[model samples]
Target chain A: MRRAGVVALNTFREAVRDRVLYNLVFFALLMMAAAVAVGQISIGIEQTVIVSLGLSAISLIGLLISVFIGVALVSKEMDKRTLHALLANPVRRWEFLLGKFAGLVLTLAVNTAAMALGLLLVMIYVKHSLERSDAVVLVAVYFILLKLALIVALALLFSCFTTPLLAILFTVGFYIVGLYVQELRNLPVEVMSPAMTAFTKGLSYLLPNFENFNVMAMAAHGRAVPGALILQNTVYTVVYCTIVLTAAAAVFSRRNLK
Target chain B: MPGLAIEIENLTKEYPFGFLHLKKKTSLEGLNMQVETGEVFGFIGPNGAGKSTTIKLLMRLIFPTAGSARILGKPISDVEMHRDIGYLPEQPYFYDYLTAAELLDYFARFHDLTAADRKERVERMLKKVGLETARKIQLRKYSKGMLQRVGLAQAILHDPKIVILDEPMSGLDPVGRREVRDIILELKREGKTVMFSTHILSDAEMLCDRVGVIVGGKLRGVGAPGTLVDMKTQGMEILFELRGTSNAPLLSKATRTGDCYRLQVAEEELYAAIDQLRAAGARILSVAQVKATLEEFFTNLVEADGTHTSAVEVSGK
Candidate 1:
């Protein structure tokens, strides 16, 4: 456990120093600034529109950052042959994988916190006041963090078998596809035979309904978010992230690094 | 056998490539060798001779297609053996953004060293490799020689029982090479098994207790350099300086004869061979048998292989 923590810390430091992290920060800041402009065109929900757009920007940029950075973790190590140093030591492969994932998640958390603070400042400046329930911005940030954690796991798993570029592409593709699980489920089963319908339904059940966890539209309209719904979304995100993480660990355990 | 640092039996690696293009090549054929504890073993080979592949196999960076390699009598597939080994690859790379101290400390932690212990070990290793003064400098600013020195320091920092170095002296100049050589000797003095792969025969000739020559993925020879160079052939000859005149007849009578060369035994023989000597040796110096040098032995091996390689190849081009 101590060794894993060390590896994690090393990975975190490496990731934090990556140029890509700076670019993500810049993009997040741009989005927070853009929310101010987006607030002027709001139909009615001035503060709501600003906060929702800011939350969406954070989530989207966080997804890109996680996928982009996470996929390259193993490939970059292999490319530079730094992995040899790690392998020559007592570090386990599973430990290395977990450490990278944890480190990246930490980066995302830090990035999310920054975005949330930026959005909060903007909301206060634009409205001259803030809603007490605007703490849901924190909710939105937590949800985005959880979702990015899952993306990190996906990127890591793909990294074991593919190049960094391909891993990122596949991971981002999966993220986009995961969001359309509702549409995939709402497809016309009557047109298809029972077998095809069952297949489609099975895939829908298997893929995460990223849409289900999206409370941006409701939060933007000032609808009350029940504790039960947050709980369900949190549980789903945790379970999905765990499943992907386990798969990544399995693949990495057998990964051959030369 | 119990003290053997590494043991291998028919280890092999076959990398499959070009599945879509309908071609594939096996990188490593069946290779078998072993190194004992506290030995400075040299794995010498030409380029693409499976030296790096063998190191990779022993490190378990890749799974073998067949056979087994054991470290400390435990299969290398076991994670426990890693703590006992340190490896320096041919191209040792690090995060360029990190200072040398940070990189060393980061690696030290993987072995569960405490902060104080890691600092001490890192400092000791850095100083031993002469990188302590530059510890705060980012690795990107380091020269190739400095990078190699840093690599050496990290590889030996934990004082592993076995240290595997692949072409560790490739980019070093004379001074750097000597420093690394001294470090390797020091490791051997401390009873650590040091197995390093190299194409430079001089390094092996000077540093190795046993050297294995590999070519085209086969173990051509394995033994001390002196023994390998001495095992091939032997020859003897004699020369005489007469008082006033040519002693052709007397010399022929005293010298040995064989089908390869015959002794000239008369004035007539001298007269006939005089023209040959005039054409070959304008001034005849004293002739004597000279024992073949190690250089000659190595050249003979490469020449005998029938590749028609140039002299540079023999000199590790």
Candidate 2:
């Protein structure tokens, strides 16, 4: 675990030096301010539009960083041939994989925090005074970060043996499936057979239910997010991340890093 | 652990190529050898001759298909044993964003060194590699030789007992190569074992206490460089300088090379040629034995049976 932290530190340093992360964070902030301008076009629902745009921008940019950086986490090292030097050390394959996972998670955490702060500033600029209920936006941003963490782990799992391009494709595909998988479990009788419903229910068990993490609608509309919902989503994200990361480590351990 | 620094027993590695893993290409085939403790061992082979593959296996970057290797008396799979050795891969790549100090410090942490120890060691390694001036500069801005120095610095940062270098001299000038040779010798003086691979036999002949020739994924020979090259000596060459030349049959093939007449005296005719040199009042400038070098042996070994890979990319690495 300590060795994993070393890899994590190095990964963070490399990502910080990269211009892409900064560029994405800058764009997220830009969109937050742009949200204010776009919100003025809608008079009565200005707050809704502003919050919606800010939260959506955070989710979009955060996942883009997560998916892209996560897929290249190992592949970039392999291409640079740095993995050879690392594996030769006291570090194991699993530790290295976990370290990369930890590092990217940390990066996403910092970037998300920055984007969230930006969203807050934009909110203050539009509203005359700070509202106590504005804290609801934090809840939504927290879910976005949790969702990005799971997406990062999924990207890592796909990256164990596949190319970065293919890993990105597969990770995106899984994200799309995860978002709508719960819908399959609750299909209407007229639109679905009993057997198909059973199959979709099984799939819901097998795949992550991303819908559980989407508090964006409630948060953006300035409605309170239930504490029960936050706790449930946190537990789900933890379980899903553990399973995905473990599977990634297993695949990486068996990999022949040619 | 006590007798040898490394031991390999019939190690083999093969990679599957075609769909369904139908076709397999052998990278290393039944390699067997041993390296004694505290000796500079040179692993000589052309590109893709399994030198890198063999090093990778010993380093546990990849597993062997059917054999076992022990490093410092521990099985290759023993993670704890990695603390006693260091490795540098061919054309190694490090994080270009890191400075020499930061890179060395990162590697030092893997050895469980403390904060102060890491700081001291990183500083010492930078000075040893002559990169102290550029310690704060990022790796991407360093020249190739500087990068090699950084690589070397990181490899030895933890002060491991054994150092494994795969083409350590790849991107260096002659002066840099001399510095590397000196560093290897210095490591030996410090009682550390060094194993390096290269196609350039001269470097091997100059620095290696013992050399192993790997061709076509198999070790063709392993012994002291002198003995290995001397065992195949075809004849001896005797050179002398004479103001005038009276043709002697033994000197029939003598050619004027600058101010000397070079003659290849047969093994049986060596004494007879010396007798003639004394009789003719010639200055016996030098009596040197002609023998095949590691390069010649390598070439002849590859020319036969067409086993080794093409030599085009060998020198590039």
For B1-317, candidate 1 gives per-residue lDDT tens digits of 43788887887766554647355345556778889888999998767667887898888787788889899889898887888999998878877888999888888877778789999999999999998899999999999889888889888888799999999999999999999999999999999999999978789889999887766555677787788876763543323333333434334444432312333333335544544544433233333334555456666665566432322232232
DockQ (CA atoms), all models: 0.69, 0.83
| Regions more than 4 Å wrong, model 2 | A24-32, A35-39, A188-196, B241-248, B273-286, B310-317
In candidate 1 chain B, where is summed lDDT lowest over 10 consecutive residues? B308-317
How well does each candidate superpose onto the true structure, as a TM-score?
0.87, 0.94
TM-score for chain A of every candidate model?
A: 0.90, 0.93
| Residue A96 lDDT in candidate 2 | 91
Best by TM-score: 2
lDDT (Cα, tens digit) per residue for candidate 2, span B172-249: 999889988999999999999999999888999999999998887889899999888877777888889877766666
Please list the Cα RMSD from the true structure of every candidate, rounded to 1 decimal place.
Answer: 6.0, 2.6
User: If you assessed candidate 1 against the hidden native complex, which CAPRI class would it receive?
Assistant: medium
List the pairs of residues colliding in candidate 2.
none
